[model samples]
Target: MARTGWLRWGSLGVAVLVLVVFLVAQRQSVDVSYGQSPSSSGTVEEGSAGELSDATVPSVEEMSALVKASPVVRLPGSTAYWDEARVNAVIGDAHILVAPPGLDEAERGRVRDVEEAGIRVIGTEVTGGAYQATADTLPDWRAQFATGDVTNLLVTLAAGIAKRPTPPDVDGFRWREPTAAEVEPVAADLRASGLHVAAGATLAKVPDSAKTAFPDGALYVALPRQPYGEPVPNFGPALVKLFPDKPIVVLYGEWIEYHGPREADFASVAAASFYGQAADRISRYAYPQGNVLHAYLNRVTDVRYAGLFDRPLPYVPLDPLRVALPALPWLFAACAAVFLALSATSLRRKAFTTTGTPARLAGLTALAIEVSGLSHDPSVVRGIAKLTAASEALAENLPDQHVRGLLDGASRDLDEVARALGRNDYLSDVYLRGRVA
Candidate 1:
């Protein structure tokens, strides 16, 4: 039964492994085809085949040269452009492209002029007006906020960000619990300081409708107070749930009255760790943004520890790998639960009444030999001794009182047979007269 159960589990594992391998192979085998186009520059235009010419497709080295020569590379516009670029296996520096938003004749002429002037034009959905307003332009955060202290604080934050050296790899800035007054200026300051604030998504505490009003590249700005009357402890996890894809950097101020000044407090660190572990990273700051903007940027870039002694460590960033890592614990737990359930099912099917059958048969055979006057033989005596030990072991496993008593009696009878053989005249009738019946 034990061997069969092991084989069953092993087969299940093998089947699952084969299925996963087969699925991966099927995905890899499918070919992805690119549409043909007629454009000389090799940028795939919006929609259908016959848009971009294959012969003019830019090589990786060529694209790199074009980007290096141009002051600003416009972001590529259509899905067709990406498909064509991917077909060439071009892996170069990311380019920024600008395009006329409309398909009007005048707009096409403008694009042609830009292309003809040695500024290689890339296809894009963004119009000239939108690009001028948002992309690379410094935002006015103070205007978005109310005319009060919150606006003043945000303006100061923006100024501080502008003065400080930009943090590495920061696509944009995200504010936790931002009020309406704080979002725009912070984004603007970061943008003016050479940080790419336009790439980030805006998640603010303002009305759901107003969240879209912030300039491109701004993260969330938190409300000053907690929302929905939730406890302070719940803020971090809830915030993380809202933006599960992006790497979270929770910048908490210690001087902020609600949090107090306990940098290494267990409850505080634990609560923060829960948030960090849920998303990407978290940090606790002892000072305000005014004096420590540089330090703040440093901490934001390298969020290894939460406090001075590294009281709480930042969690793994919510990358593809991090997203998969969490499922491991759950997978192990599910396997354990299945194992337990299987064991329980096996136990339920096992019949206790059949447990001592072998011992009973061996004991009866020994008894018959002894009664036939073979007790005097050395082989019969040894057989009786082995059968006695077997009966004793089987007695322990039989749960029924009568079965246990029967096994015990058989063991005794086997022992008596061996003992009686020692005395030449003594014939043991105990096996025939006792619990064997």
Candidate 2:
């Protein structure tokens, strides 16, 4: 029992040790690099004058000597080689440089230099108006715009601009009245589609149309007229109030302009007014130069209000010790059970036995009787036969003659039984007497 208990405990301990090892092996740590920029282009310090030499700044004579250059320079998004010198050269001869609106500070500086050279910098803010304009004329324009194919529309408009004999007016620009033909088709389409069509002569003209277009609907889209100005002081907020129930989509033909001290404030006001009122419902479409504007709009639109936000922490792998400790009690209990079972089985086997003295003695005496009857070799049957013959001789040597004779007959009968028993024929010879004869 003690041995079995020790063996059981030893097995259980080994099993638990193996389990702990397995669990430890299963533990793993995951490395996560958060907040690191994935760009392989490397980081550029802010406000670095990239690839532009100071000597490249040309004098008036140097600038005047250069031939008349095209106002429109095709500046690819990243690899434009745009320096102050090349920008000045472009500005030197052209009356107006028409590019996309919403230039960064560097670009604005470049534009300012160009404007200082008596050249006008016309930044086109292509808005949803262009989409609507094209949609009115070309039915596929809306679908194309929805799929972000404004490049196709820009190409078409650029082609149109290239073919124009005279440049479009920039200063003191008035909204070009849409022809009756243009307005009529759009109005008819809106009515047919059960959608309201609102026209704005300028940014100020949007409120009335917005109220009439969307009274209780979730969304209100206002398509502004051509040549929209930069977002100014109270204009964006006041326009937002006009559509209290719905978000407004503002579309401008020209890039919105901002200048002086009010630029940041106006941008903030514009963003806040649009976002606070409509949240994500407001979207602006500006022509050529609205990429920055679109980026800003996307930023503001992502703002979400928090009430009771809860999120599960990311799954961190548990330590091997921590995981194994919780299961230790169960493992110990299993080991204990195994030990107990082994101990109980050993104890039961030790307590009971069928090969004790009484059973063995009874079996041996029966074998002697059976051996006396055996006809096999003397050497094989000699021991049991001698014992039986000695018993018979002892009975014959007794002092009482009758008792001695009876004892001798009993011995003879016993010899016959022993002989039968010796021959492995116990069933034929051995019997317990019920009555003495």
Candidate 3:
């Protein structure tokens, strides 16, 4: 029974294993393909355009070069554009491009020329005119891309020089104070143009009136409150709530490089929080444009863009031999056969039984003798002598006729046993003769 149970369980386990293997083989396997397009010199054109040609697309390296050559540009007092150049270098021309609000035909023409040269372009309702008026223009940019005309876009600075003081390390670049009051109107224009608006750390602090105008999906650019410090906590959550459906770009302060691991940690925390909530949304965290930007740009450009990062290939199989092993059905059959063989042998063994009234009586007599100590050869004679004396005493207490008869029978038996044992002087012979009688 135990062997049979073992075999049954083993068979069940093997069957389950076989089923699992079959299911795994039947499931679709994942494969990844990576590719990239060259980026054209100049800006991206906003609005409707056909898919960019593969031939003109620059490799990631080329794009990185362009970003490195350019100066770091930013809205005055805002670190939002700090990493823009660096991000451009990494993503290259693959970014979904948006035109500043109310861009004129001449400016739009210039952007179109850039796209013809093979840079991907996405047009927004926000034109260069609007950007000049107010710095908030990402919402329109996002909406233009969401239209499906451009799947990947990059936010870039306009051609005009900025007015803000430049960092000592950066040359030929200056920051301009962003017209904060103009953000709402620009956000309103973006919303009116059908773009999703979300608020970031910087945007969250905007007046309620501005927040109401843009509502959700507006990308807020924030600078770290302290120089070379970490971003404040809860910044990511605030952005997520504001733009549940759209992506938010976080532009860290000018001193982002000084923050070190703290910046990465914060970014990771923000990424995890936001990605957990909405992976499909296009969320980006970037530091102020600088040497750090160059590093990031180089890293991203070096990647083979053929969706390699987007869709990764399965890893090399470590145990192909194990995967190719024979089916579990055979193993189960072998176990079952072994179990049956053992069971057959056990069943064929001999059986025992006892019968006959004489045999039963003999067994009972042996048990009684053993319990009374008469079976001890050396003590048997003494024990019998003592029994005879006790019987005589019992007879005296009974009626005279009954007592005399019992005593006479016991004395005769005891004398006969003692004479037989004396002649043989053998315990076994005496016991046999006594039992026979």
Candidate 4:
């Protein structure tokens, strides 16, 4: 009836409504599934093919030698397609470009023919550059270094580079950047020994295309720098597509300068090494072209190398602890919901015990009286009176005999209390009679 009572009831109604809305909003917002896309074979076509040729394919022994000797190995057939002029231009005065075994005619032809068979191939130059350079260059030998007049050697060696026919038993020399002090001495020794040499004048003259792939100048462990130009990436992708079901383990190699002289000593001396730079970038979820496979490869593949591995990329099925830990938060939320439901049920039971049940009924009757004044219509007041009578009838039938007796006494006094309030009398004749009794 008073202003404070109306304010209290109105505030309680608003608070209950707001709490319900907030809980519904929170339940709708929770998401359990990963937002990361499921692995799909993006634009890569799986196909069947027979073993075409093994003649030019490097033997396991040859690959082992190449992997150990070379600072960087270009995949498919680890060979640089650079002509002598391109080699001299990139390496400058002090360099020995070890020409390795390249793709054979059968393999190079396969690149062109695979598409005719309905397989999609990307990143291969259709023309003569990479394919022609391989057939033209000498394999498994000390390639001619810079010689005589700097301007004339490029023209002279271009024709002679592919003319050699010998395959040496020894492994090819591994190419490395020579310091300024070591340049002239190495060139002089190669020239004296009658080996054609690339002079020191052209160090880094030709910009490497591989460098362009990574504009930020952050070097990747898997990306190899070649003197000629970019290697044809078509071969690796084509072969991978043939055996789409097979799991291929790709291993990345670090720059020779990053590791110690001996493998056993295995310490990284440079901060810009593979472990330092590339891994750091990748750990921050930075993938080139937004491809995780490309991030792992450190170079973009010609095809989407997805669905190749049976398990997901960065697979962690082997670690149960890792899997379970991430799920613990969601599990805890489920448990909390169950706990709150049980607690509310238990509190309701406790509140309606013998003494509490009668008190709650009386409070409900008082609440009905307060709500009756909110509307002027007599029907609304009649409805409130009927609801209070229904609540009293339900409480009287509760199994507890003690609770029923208490409810009956509260019901008997309710009419006299209502009459005293209606008469605006704090001490009326009915209340005096009850006190005397």
Candidate 5:
């Protein structure tokens, strides 16, 4: 071969190799920064948070009135066993705590007992705490639904948070920061989806821009404010100064959670989560030790009666765009180019006809259909495929209105359904978080 020809072929091979590598690695994946396990459930066997006496379960009108009167709605039930004091504590607090998986049929029956008595059975769910949530963890409300009970509609979707700048002061804990700028985008998606988001960080430390960009959410403050004595989290609206109208919840109080000396020790920590803090709501992470449940409830009840958070806790809900306008840059560019090309060429001369085999189009369409529903919402995938088919078919000389409608309407319908079902942006959570890093 001539030297020039050899050089050109070699260069072409390198380019091809690079393109192949990029293509092979393009599927997005999210990298999770696992939180600390500084630790580390049995129920009352009956499943009640034990806070309520058998007769104390509220009635429907009272449940309604109770929630209306209080800022916090306690989920009553038990996941682990509690001591006498702890059990008493739960009843006095009037808020209930329970674990879903640990509930025996009888325990579940008691929760139903409460519900039958007119008290709202389901309440807030948490990810990992003293009882950390795994990928498989689900709230009891989900169980209620499975059994064909459709009373409460709210379920808490908690994500593991990264306390910025490594080796969080919480001791024996660590979370990896994203290499990708995943926080802003993920946070944006959460806000758009209308789900409540709480990330770990000190309000004073988080960047101003980060605070502004956060779609509506709260600060899961856990650092700097070492839990040596007791946490008297700054009360009132002072949190708004740092978070700018955002609520501040103590993920860790007095000291970080998940680090108690004994599993039961979390009872005090759980108690502290409510005591001497500014937050209207607190997560009692005392793990496995259901004994702590009552103490946790007592604090919640105490704070409520104490008239704290008399004013509404700072709340700023996130506002996402009503309709997505194609987030991919390549798609935008392709559309823009097509528009300009059609505008100039059609006006000045005959429209250019696209050339391709109908068989090739048919094959691609069949292939897309086979895989369209494999991942995300099948409706969305089918709709997107339809639109893509409609667009490509036009280019290849076959325009189908059916495909167009499928794309426009079916895709949108799927999106709405996914939202209604509380389906999260799984791809974004994983893909964006990892790829961006």
Candidate 6:
């Protein structure tokens, strides 16, 4: 019996060791430092051709020259979309791409003229009732869309997307999420079109199909927030989780209702790091009016982020930090509970414990909480105050006048920290800094 028991335990230990070794080897097999390469370096899947690999990217140097070409091709979203100067400028400066709200006859003609000039024109579709919303518009759209000048037709989904069926049977349809009731109809249409059916998803609201529906499809992401707004934290992993097997194309619609101050444009660029990894193609809107708008164009198209444009304009990505933020309170709670428990037990009834371990622990933990952007935490402030008291109690043993005075001064600073952070909302350390004096 003793021999059998020893053998059983030994077998279990060997199995556990093997499992750990396998896990480590698997992790080391792939490049895990994804933050360094925001765009994927071409990863292929079993049944599907990836989205990034699907789009033909020209040389980075050529793209850089195109972006630097000035005055760059500029097109307005509204009435002035086809200004003569803008039309003349795009001849060699840029490609003509169809996009958004609606493409008109003259604007389409201008796009065609640019195409005839050897410029590659991309066709875009705005979906969700807009496609088939009117009977007459559909036929006209189909006729214009047939021109080989347009290589791809992207369908931008609206919030009201579910209410409408996606248009079927276009040669170059960038199909995204459609209503559940219309999925079969949409899929049936795509099956007959002999076109690649790719998918488009947004950040906050990803459709179920992105994960399970389109294993072989290319991935297109509509950035969750406006260019100026911060995206969900850890947006990269979130997107990969949703569509693991597809190539990703990021879209930044830097449209402003009323373009604001310089600071707002600056805000748009702050979210660009999210695109650093896994993005195959990035596209932006063609809005020409405000400096802020131009700032957005410059932020993406400039040499710094070269080769990311998906045409019309350049694209930026969303951040991943969004999902990580909500979990921070839990982190604070865990840290607080552990340190507070340790402090209570170790410092019970003592003015100061030996080595001042409990007080130091509390102070460090509280400081960390504040650094994590939770400075307004009332419990953390109270904990710091209690620790300060403990430190003062330790000072009682110091008979040296200078040492005691310094200790007293430190205690005063602790008191001020406690007072400032007693509220609910976060107040910047800068605002509270000199006010204490």
| TM-score versus the correct structure, for each prediction | 0.17, 0.23, 0.20, 0.21, 0.20, 0.21
Residue-wise C-alpha lDDT for candidate 5, range 70-142, written one tens digit per residue? 5344444422221233223223323333333333345434445433122222212232222232112122211
The per-residue C-alpha lDDT of model 3 at residue 179 equals 48
lDDT per model vs. reference? 0.32, 0.33, 0.32, 0.30, 0.32, 0.33
Compute the lDDT of residue 22 as modeled in candidate 3. Answer: 47
Instruction: Count backbone clashes in candidate 4.
Output: 11
- In order, how many clashes per candidate? 26, 23, 36, 11, 23, 19
Off by over 4 Å in 1: 1-71, 74-258, 265-437
- By summed lDDT, which 10 consecutive residues of candidate 2 come out lowest? 302-311
Model 4 scores a C-alpha lDDT of 0.30
Question: What is the TM-score (0 to 1) of candidate 3?
Answer: 0.20
lDDT of 5: 0.32
Model 2's alpha-carbon lDDT is 0.33
Please give, for residues 87-198, the per-residue lDDT of candidate 2 as tens digits.
3422233333323333444553443454322332222222221221132222122222222223333333333434433223112222333455544544453335423334
- Give RMSD to native, each candidate: 23.7, 29.7, 29.0, 23.1, 24.6, 22.3
Of the candidates shown, which would achieve the greatest TM-score relative to the real structure? 2
lDDT of 4 by residue, 17-115 (tens): 433444454464444333333223243211211112222434445544554564333444222233444434433222122212223344444433421
TM-score of 2: 0.23
Candidate 3 segments exceeding 4 Å error: 1-175, 181-184, 191-437
What is the lDDT for 242 in model 6?
Answer: 42
Model 5 alpha-carbon drift over 4 Å, by segment: 28-104, 107-116, 120-437
